[model samples]
Target: MTVRAVRRTSLVEQAVTELRRLVEGGEWPVGSRLPGEVELSRLLGVGRSTSREAVRALIAAGQLHSRQGLGTFVASIAPVTDFDRQLRRAELAHIYEVRVALEVEAGRLAALRRTRADISALRDALAAREQARGAAELVDVDLEFHRAVVTAAHNPVLTDLFATFLDAVRDASTEMVADQGPSPEDHKHDAHAALVQAIEDSDPQAAMAATRHNVEHTLAQLRPERP
Candidate 1:
């Protein structure tokens, strides 16, 4: 095999590439703090300015987030493309429209495909939601229930796309929960129970109906008539 020389690139670009590799390769996981600029510069054999520029680039690209008084941390391994940032910034109604479309299909598919393990996971999430004591805890558990349903659909691409909307979903849920007075039951407990039953019974049509009911109920709560 003939050896090929590596093409040269700017130090900042090289640092950015290596930093991405470290993050994507799981050497640095999401939410894990990254090395300081001085340490990263020494580690990557680049100047501190180059390392700082690389970090700034990653921050702008949404792969890293820096907290005041805290070091930089990996925000996500999945690069937030322009489209994804738009999705993240989308209005609740727009995001819910897409969420309803995706989840209705996911509910049907999950009913047909969910395994025993999936059912168990869904039950656990539901139980957690029931036991949740505060608005924040309920929001987290509520999202977990939706995530379990999507996972049960057994579609990796759907799962990834849904994952990107989670922060927006969480924000919406927080607002809705706060507006509705922090009662977890105010957020579709019966509809979710029906959904779980439909999925457990492997009834696709029932699952779809249950999913639609839940989405519509949420929309009504968030956008009450002004009459």
Candidate 2:
């Protein structure tokens, strides 16, 4: 990339990161108005145009709101919570469908390229899940385990794909636990153990089977029962 391109990208990224920290860290808080364009531009050390672009991007991400004559504000008291609630069940299902596509590919690559350190990390994550007794704790470990496995695959694209849906997945899984009870935690650990073993054996087919099986099982538990 050209110097200008690099500079623009850096400025946008810096602005976004700072803005996210402000909102999420509760510095500005949600629903509060941010500093005006000129003030923000000076604060971020960027020009007005860069700040405007950054603000527009955050608005698109559902993080901020801008009014023509009024001003830009934090939008909502809990934008992430608001977005998660507004994202329909169909949207979440679509997210999971995408996750499956990316994760399956990651599993295949992990079978091909996993290193000793990656294997150890996966094992540790699985152990953490096994030790977790509560729903929230179990879900946390389960996600960390999957994240480690995906990272072990060493496919940045796959990791990015999963990262996009991480929040949605966490929200969905937490809701799922409310109905399914904690019994599934045992099954989850078992499935992950099998998946880890498959990765250790460098068996892509087994890894895929283990992964698909676990996903389907969880989906079944989460879905309402038919009369």
What's the lDDT of the predicted structure labeled candidate 1? 0.80
Q: How displaced is residue 179 in candidate 1, in Å?
A: 3.6
Alpha carbon lDDT at 126, candidate 2:
85
Residues 1-227, candidate 2: write the lDDT tens digits: 65654344477678878887887788877778888989999999998866765665565455776655467778653444544544534454565666676677777778878999999999999888788755556667788888987998998877887776676676556545543445633345678888899999999988888877766665555444679
**Per model, how many backbone clashes are there?**
0, 0
Q: What ranges in model 1 sit over 4 Å off?
A: 1-90, 183-188, 224-227
Give all candidates' CA lDDT scores: 0.80, 0.71
Worst 10 residues of 2 by lDDT: 178-187
- Residue-wise C-alpha lDDT for candidate 1, range 1-227, written one tens digit per residue: 99999988977788889999999899999999998878888999988766866776676567887675578899999787757654543455676777799999999999999999999999999888878764556677888998999999999999998887776676566545533456434455788999999999999999999999877666655442577
Poorest 10 consecutive residues of model 1 by lDDT?
A: 177-186
